[model samples]
Target: MSIDSIDAAPPATAQTEQAVREQALVEEVIRSFASGGSDRDREVMNSLVRHLHAFIRDIRLTEDEWSKAIGFLTRAGHITTDTRQEFVLLSDVLGASMQTIAVNNEAVGDATEATVFGPFFVENAPQIDIGGDIAGGAAGEPCWVEGTVRDTDGNPLPGARIEVWEADEDGFYDVQCSDGRTAARAHLFADKDGRYSFWGLTPTPYPIPYDGPVGQMLEHYGRSPIRASHLHFMVSAPQKRTLVTHIFVDGCKYLDRDSVFGVKESLIKEFAAQPAGTPTPDGRDLGGREWTRARFDIVLPPAGPSTATATKTS
Candidate 1:
């Protein structure tokens, strides 16, 4: 028989029978989890369903409110594209993304602590040779950044792929502006001795974009939309694990006043300006202007395979 004929014969139920049948359907849905899903997945989904239902009932949400919420979500989606992610911005503002990163980065012993990778990262930054200048042809003051990647035991880890990117002096990522140029960002494979060095502009504090709803929320609370100057790093190796973090520039105007509250005391590093003619590493003209320098270290823990779903970095 056709499926239409089967559908026509399905409603032979009184109110009591309907209720019982609904309960059976619910049980059947719950039991379906046991058929193929992992125990952990099944448990989590069941708990999520329960709490989600409970929340809906507890709020007694009206249809108008529901419609408004849906509209807000649609707007959020509309604001996101390849370079910008409104959902991640929402998660950042709500602090859920950072919380989840913290939960997943719990490390024992002396492993380097993990932090949320901000939403502005771009993959495949122009790969440069070791000791190459990343801050190409920019107007900001120059800085020499040198760092070593090592395990918790302090052994240099070779062959680590160190990916580095950062905002310009104006507090904008390369992708943020339409200049079609990317300075202060590059990818470099580590040397045999696990040391890495690059030249970039001295990081200056910058303001977060305040043109969107997140900005409105910040304004509603009388908050400043500023984040401290920092250099973003994502270091990974074939045998070892990966770390996504930033080296906060010390003495930044917004260090103590980050709008997103992303700074940690330990991550902050001094970027001291050296006297002129301080012997350039490249033996080039140092001019009369002072240069800045910093040394940072990255520590990686055991490797964890990437999850199927995208996990928001803070």
Candidate 2:
């Protein structure tokens, strides 16, 4: 039967004999998982089974719909690779990534808020010295980014490692390119005074990779894949909580509706525009090309036990 016909049918009646059987089945599945497993595993599985059964009951899910979902997951698995993670994209668009981040990173006094760690981050990114250019050879207007790493008590965090990466003007990360070239990504350490600066591209709004199953799902739901203009940052220091976040462009139109729901009001900053011939911080000549500058002072919270529970933020 067609999906239209199924939808047009009357809703199933509750409290029937079949409904009691369904409830027993749910309990049986939960018991199967609860029988033999680690405490954490059993806890998670039991809760998952309960929620899954509840969702199936709430929607009165059709067999065809379940098959279609399995097919979509299979397609996502097929497209995922070392360079492309379609499952991560799926989690991102559904706000699961952001929700997970929110649960893990609790709010500390005066500390920078955490956001999504996007799928594009690669291990062992090239290291750059302070005041170096992270853009490498990416195609975009020049931007001067300066920042200081400090702890919540207002003490500088020297030797902190900062990993920065972003898409180019066309909204494609280095890994997305076909030539196996790496640009627009690098890691640098804070100076003795906890100061670090680098040159990168001006932030621009870009669509998350949408040529896969997630894209098709978004289209089916009438949603856009465009993300807010932002630069990714992951900072870590000894004996301090690590932070993975972004500094979004203040005036980006998509800030309110980022595809991943990663934007936080505290993370937005002004990218002050400079006319051509504006002297850069390091006095590097831009050849009369206009550029922008932004300063982001990062504050890391003290490393300690998590005070928050793993609750969904969405």
Candidate 3:
């Protein structure tokens, strides 16, 4: 008998009645959300319910398993606070963060591709001059980073703001330090020619603070929690899209296996070794010890128009 004809007819047994009831339950829950305040919210919730109900039906999840999942989420929320963001970390390791960024920010004419912003970014980082050192004596071999920001047309984008942050040689960010003073991170501005230079440290592989629930989950899956060595940058300019990205060290040990899956071929960079006493691009001496030099050029995209411009364009 056809399934539709069977549904139209009266249920013949307890099993059939339960199956109809289960299907009705899914639809009833969806209908109950008609009062959601916004169309977007209603649409999202409706879609979520459909998928979740289908998944439950397909998997036939047990009550105990569902309860455990709820407990896990509750714990994730409990551990999340001002300094620690367990939910973002959870999204990151699951590759959801990168997927969302990719879907939302499609490429813009060869502009720099965006990536996951990780959980370490801090607002209001200190501003450093073009040739200044942002590392502030963090432990690692010195590395000089020089780059320029420009548009796809090769025109320099002067006055762009660059925010940078990275872990020290020991694989700890300044925020993780006991003193709470920022190190190895600062804000810098592109000069008139769109060039920027800063003294930082060479990238080093490190674990992603894996003592939390996410770590426990990784352990369960027998996965390593190592992230590749990389320096993070967020560049912004008026009328241009802000870019959040990272420059991966060419030979970083965990490049192929970054815990959060943030590595991209376009972002990999070579950290060339420089002999002592070599003159830097800004006329500073590389003094006495071997230092690394890496050059990364950024390409920004045109931003969406402001209200006035949008109105005019429309």
TM-score per candidate: 0.80, 0.92, 0.88
Find the 10 residues in a row with the least total lDDT in model 1. 2-11
* Clash totals in order: 1, 0, 0
Most accurate candidate by TM-score: 2
Best by lDDT: 2
Q: Rate the local accuracy (lDDT) of all candidates.
A: 0.72, 0.87, 0.82
TM-score computed on alpha carbons, candidate 2: 0.92
lDDT per residue (tens digit) for residues 1-314 in model 2: 54323323333765566777887787788778866879999888877776677768768899999999999999999998888888888888988888778777888899999888888888899999888999989999999999899999999999999999999999999998999888999999999999999999999999988899999998999998999999999899988888888999999999998988999999999999999988999999999999999999999998877522222121
Q: Clashes in model 1: which pairs?
A: 116-314
TM-score of 1: 0.80
lDDT of 3 by residue, 73-130 (tens): 8889888776678888888899888877777567878899878787788888889998
Candidate 3's displacement at residue 174, Å, is 1.1
After superposition, which runs of candidate 3 have C-alpha atoms over 4 Å from their true positions? Answer: 1-19, 283-287, 305-314
Model 1, residue 16: C-alpha shift (Å): 21
- Shift in Å, residue 94, candidate 2: 1.0
Residues 102-207, candidate 1, lDDT per residue (tens digit)? 6666674566665668777777788887778887665677888888888777788888888877777777777787777876788887788888888887888886
